[model samples]
Target: MFNISLRHSALPIALFVFTLMALTKMRPPNLWAHTQFLLSYDVGTVRRSLIGQGLAWVFESGLMQSTIFALAAVLTLSGAAAMVLFMARALARLDGGAEVLLVFVTSVGMVTFLCNTGYLEGALALVGVAALILPVRGALPLIAKCVLCIVGVLIHDIMLPTFALLVGLQLFLSRDELPVASRIALGALPVALTAAVLTALFLLSPDAAESYDTVFATVTDRALDFPTRKGAVEAVMSYGPGMEPAYDSVWGSDLYRFELIYISWIGVAITLWLLVAAARLISHRPMLDRLALVAAGLGPLSLLLVAFDVSRLLGVAILHAFLVIAVVLLIDESARVKLRSVFTQQAIVLLLIVNVVVGFRPLNGYPEFGDDFPGAVMELPLWWNMPPSGGRLTQNPGE
Candidate 1:
């Protein structure tokens, strides 16, 4: 009886373990994250200062590491809850059982949230989740959606591509329910609002009145410990020169180096796997619908041209794809039927085993790209056996 009960309760056990792992591995708010909340209108209006400005109004100079940590936890938990709810609803439609849920909990997109806790990624994901839920599940006013998009952009301009992909796909999928003019306006409104906000932030916001040293001093004074990554604070304060130093490191000619290329291909493979899974869930749809969905899923990758955070962006793309898929599963019976046919117990069990082996890792800038790739677990044994004089593992293996 005990063994039988344990077998039946495996799913809940797995979920509990996964949550514990995420909590245990949670990192402290880094200097970049601290710098984001430290910035405010008092320093002069700047890009990505909205959150800081709002916190400043409420905290009235009481912002500290504890506050930032608490806020980060809230945002991360809120986003995770939203995502799990959506996933649960979608799985319900497919009659997906323990194995399928296990696959989801272990999947790269979900695990990215677990491993890379406490960053704007959580807040950005929350906005994306709102985009998914509000359109289908709620009667949220158009103005509210517009306001959400505006807030998303203000949080970080990276929200633009993510917003575009999600909102555009949702609008596109609603073609049968809404009129042509309404759809066009609905689509264009967010774009226009985003553009206005971006212009105001970049062109109209006042330049920093203080030097990097002055701003850094002010930020460190509020912290319990010395903030690491001074360059991040410098970037926020100086705006231009401080940003230049990262260019060569992140986007240098070595972009095409063999290791980076290999890691990038691994990311691409994982992305393709996700796209394939989404496609399978909607295989019964028309060719146009299928193509459009795939296109939207691929859209976030365009951020590559401007951003060097390959793994993080790919994780965003994967989550964006999942959110879009969940929306479709909730609203479209045809898609749900396709998902049911594709996600059999045997298939889900096999996928779950594979995902568990892949496990989870932090997906950030280049080299550390993609959670699906072999990470610390795979490399640790080799490191343990290496000669003492070999030194630590550097980003570039040749070094």
Candidate 2:
């Protein structure tokens, strides 16, 4: 009874069970363990997802993107800290009851990204949130935030679509709620910003876009598939000239498999969270609960809908939001603490611990590299073309 009872055998057994439990519950690793991958390539979402994955690669290898991403991350972290302090100050000046939730939403998007990714996409997103919540009662605040967001567009084009999405989402959801003049005013800034960017990109040219991507990719090492990336992109894009979809799906098989795993989990968590939220809202429409859901979902669903290529981003965004929402929903509002339900609470804590462990691997194994090594990763994408991974992909990706 006092003996350890053959602990070595139990170690592998324990790890096996733990690994199985995590994989069964989630496919992605680290901070976004609960997330699912996406399928659609809605332009905006694609750019951001690419920014994340591409940046991770560059940072990991200490290759093409290391310097730029390192610099960008530092810059983003600094900028976010400053902005949050500013946002908090700005919030203090406001009087709306929803303003506190607005600040929390801003913090979740800005602060969390600063902690996790710190890519240019996240940085640009931070600026846009600053613009959105800068409290524009008069023209000065509005003009300032809009201008800041516009300026940020050059840093990452992903922000453009996000701006459009936010404006559109607000317009669609609040159309009946807002007066006509308020609607027009709300539409003007984002519409103008989108038009200007589209015109600029249109005028920029294939050669220019290619050149810019190359330079940016070189600088950040986060370029989507560098045209010359010999392994995957080249093998596919280089296929005998006549190809149906310009992308190289042939070389992309491995990438696609990982993509499938990530997207499937995102679907599971999002639908689960939304249904749960809907059910709670239907039963008891508390202002606080509604605020929690709104804040929790805002950035993620926005990114998912606007994503351009990879479904992985949806998986990335959804579970992150779902976990936070689930926590907020179940927590005891009156006690100054709460719980969504027993299941969700356990899931959230377990997920938090796992993600922390996952996050550290990229740092330890890779060291100079930004992401985890082979064994460190639980991501199916990382193990694509392998036995179990390939088998996992057999059933039409997410199905």
Candidate 3:
């Protein structure tokens, strides 16, 4: 179970406050679109689908903007806390107290992505991270993990298939710990429950038929929104060829693409690095560990199939897979394979590189370029700048 002792409470509290202030200062203009559309229940908005509006609706409608941001900070800390505790427990189980530094390094990587610019993603990604590390030996934890995995899909459908497979793999591998009956039921439970939830939310609504009609129209409209060049073969083409410039006027295209592409490459590199490490570490491990390595290792392939924002997808997948790798490393550490030796001077170099790349966002003259250095330090290098707050149109459509 996750206990909040006095000693550990301070860290989460501090993280919450720090993240709250940072996210507050880091708030971009475009954020309003996501919140406003979700809060208004505007099912016709095609850009951000309603798949993952469960948590967004809660935060946006249940609280004032200022209060809701604080809630976001709390959720961010909660995800960070999960990472720290999970890593710590994994290390302790391995009797690798000497390699606490490795735990710290891993925790920092998780935080870098989990606490990234988007407040909503912080919660969604945290739920994803928790699924990766939650204790599954017991029935309760396993069920909870399934529920979270389902909820994660509902929160953002872009990575649904990838993460759903991940949840399934975990359930299938827990056969040794769980009875055959339990394993079979758990495997089927998540998808069943998810279907139930979706039915209740969208299908059972007052305008059930109209809801589906609106959803179809919205999806079709969004698909047509991005037309290819005259002779292009695919619907989605790379930026700069045929697509018109759609960057917000405030960003002015000065540093967006270069920085974005830079981070995308970084995301790919980190994803490969973590998976390669897991492959090596889990070579002789139990079936569960080996299967998890495969699932986490291949989860990033979603990038190729889905054209959602590359920066967020890659970054989130990298961190999510990194957490799985860290878990495998700790679980499979042999008497011969020591943490100290696993991460030597090379680990220091890796940590430094991650901090530099993940720490800095592209220069967008945010908070007035040189004006808010403190915000820059806490929330600099936002993956993308949103339109200003309060500038969003917020008329409720589905009310």
- Give the candidate number with the greatest TM-score: 1
Better of 1 and 2 by TM-score: 1
> Which lDDT tens digits does candidate 1 get at residues 1-399?
111123355446556856775675455555566666766666555567677778877877546677787887777766766676666656562445344555666666666665455667678767866765665323464566777888888887777777655665666666546765665566566667877887777764433444555655655655544464554454443344444434345455333232244345655666666677777776766666667677767777787676565555666666766666676676677777676456665656566565555533353222343233344333545666853221232342111
Clashes of each: 0, 31, 8
Provide the lDDT at 217 for model 2: 40
Flag regions of model 3 displaced more than 4 Å: 1-37, 40-63, 93-118, 129-141, 158-166, 172-261, 286-292, 329-338, 357-399
Worst 10 residues of 1 by lDDT: 390-399
Model 1 accuracy (lDDT, Cα): 0.60
Summarize candidate 3's per-residue lDDT along 1-399 as a digit string, tens digits: 332222334345434543543444333213322232232244532222343244345543333435444555565556555555555555453333324324343332443444343334555556766675666567788778778866664554433544454555555544546675666566556655655554444433323223444443332332222221111111111233343323223133423343244445656666676666556655655664565556545665565443423444564565556555455554454622654444444553565456434532311113232222222333333334753222221221101
Q: Which ten residues in a row have the lowest lDDT in candidate 2?
A: 31-40
- Cα TM-score per model: 0.78, 0.46, 0.57
Candidate 2 lDDT (Cα, whole model)? 0.36
Stretches off by above 4 angstroms in model 2 are 1-70, 79-118, 163-181, 184-188, 208-251, 267-312, 315-386, 391-399
Question: Clashes in model 3: which pairs?
Answer: 29-386, 29-387, 29-388, 30-386, 30-387, 52-154, 52-155, 361-381
Per-residue error for 48 in candidate 1, Å, reads 2.0
Overall local distance difference test of candidate 3: 0.45
Regions more than 4 Å wrong, model 1: 1-18, 135-140, 178-185, 205-224, 234-248, 252-259, 284-286, 345-347, 359-373, 376-399
Two-way TM-score contest, 2 vs 3, winner: 3
lDDT of 2 by residue, 137-207 (tens): 45686567567656555445545544443433333223325665665566456646755864564444223
